[model samples]
Target chain A: MESLLSYAFMQRALLAGFLISITCAILGVFLVLRRDAMIGHGLAHVTFGGVALGLFLYLTPLLVALGVAVFSALGILKLKERAGLYGDTAIGIISSLGMALGIILVSLAGSFNVDLFGYLFGNILAIDPEEVWMALILALVVLITIVLFYQEFVFLTFDPESARTSGVQVRRLDKLMAILTAVTVVLGMKVVGILLVSALLVMPAAAALQVARSFKEALMISASVAGISAIAGLVIAFYFDWPASGTIVAVSGLFFLVLFQARSYRKPAQEELNERV
Target chain B: MSTNSSLIHVDNVSFNFHGLKVLQDISFSISPGDFLALIGPNGSGKTTLIRIILGILKPSSGRIVLMGEEVHQFTQWQRIGYVPQKATLLDPYFPASVREVVAMGLISLKRFPRLLTRQDESSIDKALDRVGLKGLKSRRIGELSGGQQQRVFIARAIVNGPDVLFLDEPTAGVDADTQARFYDMLAELNRKEGLTIVLITHDFGIITKHANKVACLNQRLFFHGTHEEFCSSQAVQDLLRGEHHLVCHRH
Candidate 1:
């Protein structure tokens, strides 16, 4: 473990973990609040297509993925608005189609030097300097956006109709949120992989919800939990030669389970007190 | 009407949903300080009509004017406050306190990304005070009783200090005493604050006691006039007698 920090790649991996965890933790709060976890899943798969296209074209995968994910996000928003289809259904369709396209692109690329397995399962130790820069910039952008629109987003999540009547441009905010979630999910894919990104974006927030009494508190706790999970998972994976993404998800899952049990145990006691009063 | 000016004007508006007409040729004008009760049967389109007026839904025909401008063109939504039916439809477990919910009313007035200011905090406190919920400002929304929860929503609606307030069944599911007190507060707001009010309710007894004007709707406007005129109308009398079950009949 001592020698692990000496390697530049391991140091980069640790930094990447911190950045990705904080970003995912913050975005997860909104995703869980909006009940858009499936959209996060869908965006991850769509970003896979973008990554595949980047590999096939010999370009930066993050840029390609960002473009594809944003386009897909906007498409889903427009389709949902026009057709009145359920958001989850739209996400499912888009995600699967994007995945299928990605598979076809990977097959066509044939004999590439890129490690497809790294993107699929995530190899945090293999993160390059360019990818770290991408993660940092994306995290900064998402953080700024959240700070700017926190209140509007909160209102839109709780009661969209009331938000609109109160002069919140609900549709515009909704579309912007979708786009932001897509971008965040795509950026996180490099750290947690397509299959596990949604977990990073959901579980810590769910855990925070069990304990948090207010929105701001929930956000703070969630970010902290995510940061802890990422560092612990990375360290555990390093010492034991385990998959980093799987370990991170498992850490978050444990937190969620513990919080769930704690909440359930306290609920009946609180209700009993209410009854006696 | 003291020449104060009309705030909302509905002209021959009609709406249809899936080949069934919901509102037919309804016309009425609401002045700046009028407290109007919209009473009808369950399918009488009271909610629909309110949504149309708020521009949440578009009428198939006719026009609505708000503050001397077309409703569609009225961009200053801060002037209106609306409470929808079924507050239960919102997620109760959401991690928002009563104060946070009320502060949402001021979101539109601020530039994006800015935190709440001292003035916004004072206004939120005042709105909570008005709704008699000042002590519960820090309480989680899910922790409140039903009546308290409804009052929290009312506080949110009024926090913006709008000119007009619309409530859809604000007292539904609340106890009779709570309902009575809620109306008293509403009446006080209307009379003392000079706020125009439109309430959609199924309770005619309360409507007759409180509303300055009454509109009876049964998929169409059965009557639109003063409370005395509504009570004297033959169609309204038939409605009160349960002759019209297609639309909600307010006594």
Candidate 2:
């Protein structure tokens, strides 16, 4: 463990992984509660297309992916707000277009490049000092935004109709959320890879919801779960020489399953006790 | 009602959804402290009308003036409270206590960085006390019974002490005893607090006893007058007795 910490790559990987996971988990709580859980997955797919376009044009891939993902996220919001499309339907449509664009771009590039492969499977050890700094800055921005608009997001998620009638700027706040989610997804692609980044967002929140008694507890528990999973996954991957991204997602899945089982077992006993009363 | 003193003035309002005429040429004015019941058969545009009045849905034509300002330009939303339909149908796993849910009602009254004040806490307590749910303020909203959940939403709507409150189907699926108690609480709020209330419900038998005015709507305003006038209106009587079956139908 001491020698592992001495390695600069390992230090960068751990810092970036921990920060990205916490950001994803916090945003996941609101998205899952609002039934927009699929937005993360959709945005990740769009990022795939963005990466491909960047490679095709010989531009900075991460920056291009961030731009494409943010644009697509806003597009999804517009489709829902203006066209009245259902959330999942809009996500599905936009994500499909993104993936389609990616496939064409990849085919046109004439060969699957090693650089693109790193994004697909994630190479945390390959994450340089620049990407680590990017993760730190972006994660702080997302967390701060969540803190600033915490109450408004809660109201908007719980009952948008009531929130709007109460004079809350539901549309403006929704766009803010979309932009935040897009940023989180783009940053997360480096830590967990494009394919499994949604797991980092979804699993912790789903597990936390099982036992959380309040929204605050849910957010806290989710961040802890994700942070722990990231650390555990990294340690295990380093020791066993296994894939880090896949291991991280697997750990999150395991947390969800355990929490789900524990919640189910406790529920019947609590109901029986209530009946006795 | 005098237009100057009216809290809500609906002028030739009409709504269309996907080319389907939902409400047409509807006009009425609500006075301060008046308890108005909006009744109609299923799909008769009752919810749509209230949404329009609340600016949730824009009308196809005409205008709505709230508290002297046109609806589109009205910014004093803190003065308006709303309890939407199926308030009790919240997700059973939603992670919010009754207090937290009620605090959402106070969000509109605040600006950016909308933190609750010490006074806001006491107001939440008083609102819960008004709805007789002060003891369950910490309980998770999903844990409450259907009737209790309904009261939680009422507490939320009234937490801000708005001048006018709108409730859409507050008693649906509740037991008869709970339904009677709900109406009694609404009547007390309207009578003692002078809170103007616009309610949408199918329970005519009990609403007529509590509501001072009744508006019969089925894509058009059939009647808008004192409850006593509603009882004697021959047109409404015929609709209620006919296959329209406005009272017995459920949406």
Can you write out model 2's per-residue Cα lDDT over A1-277, one digit (the tens) per residue? 9988998899999999999999999999999998888999999999999999999999989999999999999999999988999999999999999999999999988976798888888888799988888889999999999999999999999999999999988999999999999999988899889999888889999999998878888999999999999999998999999999999999999999999988877543335323432
Per residue, candidate 2 scores C-alpha lDDT tens digits across B76-174 of 998999999968578988989889999999988888889999999999999999988888777778877677788889999999989999999988888
Candidate 1: the clashing residue pairs are A148-B113, B40-B248, B41-B247, B41-B248
Model 1, range A1-277, lDDT digits (tens) per residue?
7898898988998898887888888888988888787788898899889889988898887788899999999888887888888989888888998999899998897645646677777777888998888888888888888888899888887888888776777888887888788878876787788888888899899999997767888899889888889888888988898988899889889988888887776543335323432
Candidate 1 segments exceeding 4 Å error: A1-3, A111-114, A265-277, B1-4, B242-251
In model 2, what are the clashing residue pairs, if there are any? Answer: none
DockQ of candidate 2, scored on C-alphas against the true complex (2 decimals): 0.55
| Candidate 1 lDDT, B1-251, residue by residue in tens | 22127888888899999899999999888988888999888988999999999888899999998887888888777789888896745576788888898998887667756489999999999999998888777867777766777888888888888899999998878888778888888888998999899999887666777788888888788788887787677777776675532232332
